[model samples]
Target: MSLILSRLKCPWCETPVTKAELKEKNLLQVYLKRQAFPCPHCNQSITLPERAEKMISSGLFVSVFLAPVFAYGGWLSINPALLFSLGVALVLTGVYFQKLQKVTASHE
Candidate 1:
């Protein structure tokens, strides 16, 4: 598992991009607008290719499909308001991780 995750690294510094380090807000801009920002590790520009886009879209699909599951899970915890919001957060996190894995300047 670590080896597979180690593949997701910064092209410049080779530092692993952790799930906690990813920015969820900019993911949509990067995927939809073909926009890019600086790398969290090396501060270099990171671009996503077609493969990355496909991966992100698929991740999003899975997230959406499983949203009800997350909502229900949250409902089990008795946080009624968390039902939909928790699901949305899960999808955004999925997208962020997909971008982290797929966005690499070397891959571009």
Candidate 2:
């Protein structure tokens, strides 16, 4: 499987942000809102793309769909491990999409 690397960067300073930091801060909200937040590196306001809102919605749908299947399969085989793995996969995919979201400069 090919890994999708995040291209999320600060618009003002062009500093790259890691997936961990994105998830930790729930930066997806910023992206969805096309809102500005101060960058840790430069203290300048950074804006993310509004397009990510759609991606986040889609990812949630996929996760919701897979969740039941994985849970049912695990229960049938007496192996609950698959359910946990599926949950992790869903979370990772969501994060990857968040990272993949294109950053657009908001016209203020």
Candidate 3:
């Protein structure tokens, strides 16, 4: 019989699992050796199944968690170059995710 990977869903949010979000709150290990994923919609760290946990942690996610208030606090002190650097970082992050998607698609 062929192996079937299980899809993990969030118990609280009832959404499919995402690798990145799962890693955020240390939930991936709970389902190790099983096929499961974390739901992207809810803050709940649900589990799901997959060949591997490969998810892109985008700048948007990081910014939401780490930027804004920090940026605002230094908005007056920091130069425009700081924002430009952040933009560049975001662009690179997007490109990296695109590349990851292409690679994963080819595998499937």
Which candidate has the highest lDDT of all? 2
Candidate 2 lDDT over residue span 1-108, tens digit each:
112236666656677865466557676456345566555556566665434445545555545765566566654563345544555565565555453222335544
- Candidate 2 displacement at residue 57 in angstroms: 2.6
Candidate 1's displacement at residue 87, Å, is 28
Candidate 1 stretches greater than 4 Å from native: 1-7, 24-34, 52-108
The local distance difference test score of each candidate is 0.49, 0.53, 0.43
Candidate 2 lDDT at 71 equals: 61
Candidate 2: where are CA atoms >4 Å away? Answer: 1-8, 16-33, 66-106
lDDT of 3 by residue, 1-108 (tens): 111134434566555555566577675565454433334465433323232223223344444544555566765565544554565577464444331111122332
* Model 2 / residue 70 / CA error / Å: 13
Ranking by lDDT: 2, 1, 3
On the 0 to 100 scale, the lDDT of residue 100 in model 2 is: 27
Q: What's the residue-level lDDT of 90 in candidate 1? A: 51
